[model samples]
Target chain A: MERKVVFAKPEALTDAPTHYCPGCTHGVVHRLIAEVIDKLGIREITIGIAPVGCAVLAYNYFNLDVAEAAHGRAPAMATGLKRVQPDKVVFTYQGDGDLAAIGTAEIVHAASRGENITTIFINNAVYGMTGGQMAPTTLPGQVTTSTPFGRDVKIAGYPLRVAELIATTSGAAYVVRRMVTKPATIASAKKAIKLAFQAQRAELGFSLVEILSSCPTNWGLNPREALEWVEENMAAYYPLGDYKVIDEVKSLK
Target chain B: MAKILMKGNEAIAEAAIRAGCQAYFGYPITPQTELLEYMSRRMVELGRVFLQAESELSAINMVYGAACAGARVMTSTSSPGFSLMQEGISYIVCSEVPAVVINVMRGGPGLGNIQPAQGDYFQMTKGGGHGDYNVIVLAPTTLQEAIDLTILAFDLADKYRSLVTIIADGMIGQIMEPVELPEIEPPQRPEQPWALTGAKGREKNIITSLYLGGLPLEKVNLRLQETLEEIKGNEVRYAEYMLEGAEIVVVAYGTAGRIAQTAIKEAREEGIPAGLFRPITMFPFPYDRLDEVAKGVEHLLVFELNAGQMLEDVHLATRDRLPIHFYGKMGGVVPSPAEVLAEIEKIASPQRGER
Candidate 1:
């Protein structure tokens, strides 16, 4: 008997290297998403939406057909694409600034409507793309370029807990928050992404996987220090947990 | 197809549904609010998506979403709301998403009036949004034409894979007229292999308009320019009345065109050889026919509900061959047929210096 080989390169487009700074977990999350599409054998039919913040250039790295949405409007655009082409896999990669701030209404309505699309929300606790601005997910005491004197709760208010808020909505089928600072966390992040895509494929409604990513350049930390910083400062504020898992809940319902 | 009396707004809404528009997203603005009211009552019974969005911005985005999903989606707004929607409209154009936008224009540079105006002519034709792009604009003169052109707008949108705007005014949206609804057929939608439903077993297709490289972006622009040229060549439409042997021609569109038609009738009855030229496709401007009319006529009168917006195009078409007289009513006022007829008579009278 003769053995035949059937291995090939990932179908994602081979574009320029990502524009994320060193130690930024956006690259890791991107690789993991690419791997999920490859593993699920859906790279050829997957469409990713790029938001206006750090992931704005997501079209460059993701080999699939990528649509760049205006700041904070990715969810709405994804809803359009997914509703029209319900057979193709649709996902949105959005940043904390884009998702929780300017696009708040879109996010809330899309979640409430349970639009059958996947959202990959990267919450770095700071606006990475726009030079260390205070984001909606910024930690309470963390100082950004904007919150120079530490986030004064009296004025700036506390950081928003998006996963928790979105999880309360009936439209959200799966909502999880996972950090990507270590290998174990990375493995769990991959699982979350796979399950989110699975929920989308099942037509179970909207799925969101919030990745707690590191922004070393924005955080004013070295690569290794940034990884440690996310593990130390961000993890406590945005605890890693599955807020809602539809497969388990549906079995009960 | 027997004529039935219908409110202009209700007729448009019914015609849109009958034409197989499965989803509608809109924000309420005065003068055109009845459109949304009609959709709200009808869409639920028809099993279609009808959402009164949080804002005009979100409404257009919802239309964008539904269009991307391969549904025949539409949205309606008045002037201020339409202005708010320009961002998403630009995105739809750049992404080549097929959808319909109905701008029942009221007056404004800012909330000008709730009545009627032809002020948005430049905004509709000259790329109201922020981009180097164009939307297929249809100007309907009657409630019947409103229904017919709206259905045609969807077809043109899909055929060209672009956005189409039915640019009417509050008069058309508010007035009652007899219209015959066309027999609605199930739309024969093209295969959207690029749509993002699920990967299933096919290759993932991404629909994007982001081309960073200069060479690739130029190629996209060239292709778009070519598409516009083809649209202009084939889609220019107009109605010419009494131009074969007339001394004066009046140019107008939408509500103003209907007024011009009446003016032409009155002028002829008054022993003045006056004609009317109504442009259906405002973007293409019907320059060829305008030139033809210009050659036979000694004077041209352009009437509008704005500060002589389309008159500029009429002048460009006639190349100043005939002296063009302008009559307009601004701030949501409609130019009456009597007023337009008076302008026609003024232009039709033999010039003091000429034979």
Candidate 2:
């Protein structure tokens, strides 16, 4: 049998030029969503909710039907659209500040309610669109525009562990954290996205894939150094692993 | 169609279901909580989506999401919750997505009393959310009109690709009255050949509100203004009662209109030529008709549950044209017909006596 080309375009994203800064991992993540949609053969029935922030214009970049949601409300919006049109594959693409901050309640309850939608959470540990302010996921001792004196754990409290906290929610059918900095990690990230879309298609409950990405422009580092910085500083706070899988728990129960 | 006695809140919920609204997202707020409770129990049985969101903000956004996918979706809340939802509401308006929001008016600058108050008149009729956008607002006085207008709200929303609001007070939401239930019909949604569900056999569709530059964004705003102007021209609705040969016309809406009706009856009995003008559409406010009535009427009394919100509109509609009298009760206090008649008597008395 002839080997087919696996690294082809996914129909989920449009072929238009992306507006992300050079070396930003957002472009890679976009490609991963497209690849997953193409692989699952559900690109035709997928509705993506774009969040306010850096990805506000994602509708133009994504070749699929994409709707822009208010800052931090992508998950809630996706929940509404998915429930109304159950047959449609709905997902929300959100950033750290939008998701872990303003949208905290929406994210928690959508997961708690077991909304049958997918969430692609891009955790860059800083507010990229707002000019690199410290984020909920910002690591201790890491300096950001708001935390110029370094993030004091005592003053700011410990960084939020969103994936770990959400894993404890029984409504979440699947929860995982993956990095997109390296080739192998990229493959795993792609696989995770595929699983999320598949779970949505199977009528499974809520699924969240937290992607560890780099905002080199905001991190005060060169493109190469930012990738390395994420691996060294961010990885410790946002650990990479499958925090929970509902099917496994269901079988045990 | 059969008429049955139902509470206003329950009537709105039943009307939503009958309008083929397949999803409802809401958080509990007094006066409007019954609407959510009714949907929670009925939606599942009807195979619709019902979710009690963690907050009003999320609930409205959930409605936004469902609407973007071409689903008829809605949420209900009182004043305070509606405040939290302003950001999301702005997004819905800017994005041109269709959804319905029910505001059961309550007194407030903060979490004021939960009793009926029409304090949200300015917020609902004027631009509540940030941006140059207007939502089609419908105010229903009776339970039957509540159900009928709720259905009409969805139709207007879909037809204009805009958000629609059914603005009523706590009194309307809590009161019981006879309502004729209409058959639920699915809205004629334009084939969003552009919605992103997946790429199967169709080209990818992108729905967004982002305009990168000034020129493109201005064009979007211009289009929105055009649509609003068209709506203003065609959708203004009101009811005129005994205004043809009346001297004083009482202007009101929702439950206040009901009280005004009673006040009109008493005023007529007392040999005063008083009538009522109840506005059903508060946004495309029955300004033209009110202006027409203002030409012949000597005094226009605006009765409201708020301190004096709707009075502003009444003043605008009749300013320079006639004299407009304002009477209101705040902090969830509902004015009695006697109280309103008293104000009318003061305004109509030949010799203006000292206060």
Candidate 3:
């Protein structure tokens, strides 16, 4: 039997080595986005805005024209870029800390305005870039740098459900929450990514797909356990399902 | 084109259109709300990009996005609102994106007042945001000057690839005057190899101000400093009135400068030799021209709406050789032309008035 190459690097992804920690899912998330852009034939005309957190170096990975936005301002930047060059496809890759906490105002307003853009929100539940600090998505009773005593719900508010909140906004044409830690969920995450891009291409308004990723180093667990943690804890709070989808997007093949 | 009587804010809006501005992002603040309102419609009708951002922070970042996309962009705001834009402005400065920001100044320190004030003189001329970067600031006294400078701002922005600010006061923003709009010649843009306009058939472009490691960041900083020095050497602008032979000079700009002109005429007719020095570009503060104006003058009276901010620059320019005085009215109070003359008369009095 002859073994041919079953896997190859996506041409849309740059050759630059990612600086993510061992077993971190940021690499997988990046690859999925690049794959979606390539499959849609938009890699030549796509512009991406990288957030200020761990994925701040996302520009180095994507071969498309990319710019780094301020900590939580990627959505606002995307609004401007998309509106200016309506013919080009624009998107932003933001992390939990960048999108939910510091940039809530930007994301809410951009979606409310029905901006023609796409956003990839990574919800790992902790601030991975800053050594595992408490994030808006931090689960109840989860310990972090700022919450050494196992996150007190009274002192620190409950975790924010970004997908649910944005789904309520009239402008969000497609909103979904998915996990990429398991092989089965990873396939669904890729499909969600594809559908989100399809929504943007159809000019159905704002679209977003929140992916629950693993940060083994920050979680103090091995790579395998980290995936299980996302599967058990994170998926429970942020359930995997479609939160919002417009009629036209739902009718897509 | 035809000379049209219009409000100062409206003229600035029309002028930006004539200058081939492709995008406008702004949040509504007093004094500049008209500018935003005008753009909200005109930009759409002209098939351009317009967005009323959620806040000043979003508005300025939007400008950053458009500039990164290689489009002519601008934003306008008032005092308190302008403060919120400092973070984004600092990023633009560090990234060296060419943009125009119009500051229709109002009272300061807090919500302040909506009335006309020059409290932002230092903020506009100096580096208001973090880092060692300066914005090219132009103070326009009249509606026509606002129209002219608004167009010039785009050229100077593209030429230097830096942020250029047109600093007007609430009066200039609200006042009505006849202005001849600059002819609409598609704006001149310089070569931008750093713009993030998709790869298409070219190499990928990244627009970021981040430079990790010491030596690399230092190299970028040193290059930016060199550009600033070049700007200082070439772009110094000012105007003089009755400086041929004078014993007293009133240094002012924007609305204060226009007020000083009246005071200079009255002082001259009252047998006191008085002249005016109006700085068109406040960053490169026209110090050399101020030295020339200070040659025969015994007193330099710097009048403003704030507390003696520009006087510091006057002292530096005159090298403290001549006696420099300051007369300011804070809290949104504009000094009358008579009040400026009275200060000048006090200088000319026998007692030299309380020094």
Candidate 4:
């Protein structure tokens, strides 16, 4: 029999211990991004701007040029990095709280300005780092530390369809939403990240892929239940699909 | 170089471009709005990076990103806008990224008037953001000094790996003065190995402030302290006028300092023997010089556009050995030269200048 290695970690991902909770799917999404960067042969040129949330230590895990950004300001940060160093592939890895809350203005403006960059948005309904506070994307009737009884649309407001919102921006080159809970979805999520990076490689305008992620610790469920919750609940509200592409953008290729 | 008549705000902007700042991220706010507008036009003409951010919060972070990527970047704001940037400022200092910030201070505690006020003296010198850190603050009074300091700000910031503040007031910002711009080619910054350009053919570079363990944080803080001590030793700057045989010295900076000079002259003609001691650098302030001056004066009168903020530094330098009196005008009301003169005259009077 010939010796062969069938599977291995992506070169972009460092051999570092992850700090994610047992059932959380952030590690899966991280791997998907790493694999995408590796396959594109862009690991050396990629500069990742990590947000101020659970993946704040993304710089440590990703074996590439990385910069830590203040909460919700990664998109704006990416814009600066990309604009100054157009040769460098700049991207921002932001969570729901970082993208939809305080950073909403940054993303909207970056997209509006048509910055040449990529954004990986992790849509976990709760604030994972602060111990499960209700996030802007928290589903209606979802319970978290901030919404003890359950989130009522009347009191807590409805969840923002971030993918759809970003899709509406004329400067957005590509906008997508994908799930990473299941193995099949993980492959698709990786594809989405690749397309987003590809758009940037072509000097396209802002590209974003919102990944529906699982925060089992914050959701008060096992990792298995979190995946099930995404299949049954999250996927329905934030239907996974390509919302926008370069064809619709006038300035981008 | 031919002297050009320019507003303080526009002069600072032109000086920054001449000083080799490649990128500028700013939001429009009064008093300093011209700074952003000038950069907007000049950057486009020069093919440099310029962006009018949606807000001050985004602007500072943009500077943060550009600076980490090995570009000299800057931003400008007023009081409320500067307050919004506290978090980013804290991060910048902690991450040790070199950036230049120009605060054309307006009256503040909140949404205060756009008129000039030196209310931000304490905010600028004593570290507005959270942490045990200090930024090298250069308080420029004259438009010429504003131009000179703005140019020096970029160099000193990069040289020390720290943020440098150009604290100007609306009085200086809106006024026109003749300034001889320095004629020097903007030197291209050599590659900084520490900056995160890319990981190609080299180890990855990370621009981060997170020190998880206390031991690591302690080490980082100690290193920062060491840098600060070096700055304190060599970077102190100030200017004194007519300090010889003075009974009272008016300690002021920026616009207030400019006004104090007029007051001191009138007081001198009145035979009051008053002089002006102005701090050129707010942080790493000319404390030793002020102490030297404090020993000769009977009273150190601190005048400001705020309710006695820089009085704290004057007190620290004098250390109660000398009596310090604070005279301030707040809420966008800048005292006239006569008002300051009266304060000096009152301090010299036997019946009025009592302890």
Local distance difference test values of all predictions, in order: 0.85, 0.86, 0.90, 0.90
Instruction: Point out the worst 10-residue segment of candidate 2 chain B by lDDT.
Output: B190-199
Tens-place lDDT digits, model 3, residues A1-253: 9999888888689999999998899999899998888888998899999999899888899999998899899998888788888888899999999999999999988888888899999999999988999999999999889999988999998999999999999999999999888778888999999999899889999999999999898889999999999999999989999999999999874
Tens-digit lDDT track of model 3 for B90-151:
88888888899999999776998988898888887888988778888988988999998999
TM-score of the second chain in each model? 0.96, 0.96, 0.97, 0.97
lDDT of 4 by residue, A134-215 (tens): 9999999999999998999999999999999989998899999999877789888888888888888887789999999898
Q: Put down candidate 4 lDDT per residue, B20-94, tens digits, no spaces.
A: 889999999998999999999999899999999999999999999998987989999999899989989999999
At residue B41, what lDDT does model 2 achieve? 97
Q: Write the per-residue lDDT of candidate 1 for residues B83-163, one digit (tens) a residue.
A: 888999888887777899999999887968898998998888989988688888999989999999999998988888889
TM per candidate comes to 0.89, 0.95, 0.98, 0.97
Which candidate would rank higher by DockQ, 1 or 3?
Answer: 3
Q: After superposition, how far is residue B64 of candidate 4 from its true place, in Å?
A: 0.3
Off by over 4 Å in 4: A1-4, A248-253, B188-191, B351-355
DockQ score for model 3: 0.83
Which of 1 and 2 is ahead in DockQ? 2
Give the winner by TM-score.
Answer: 3
Q: Which of the two, 3 or 4, has more TM-score?
A: 3
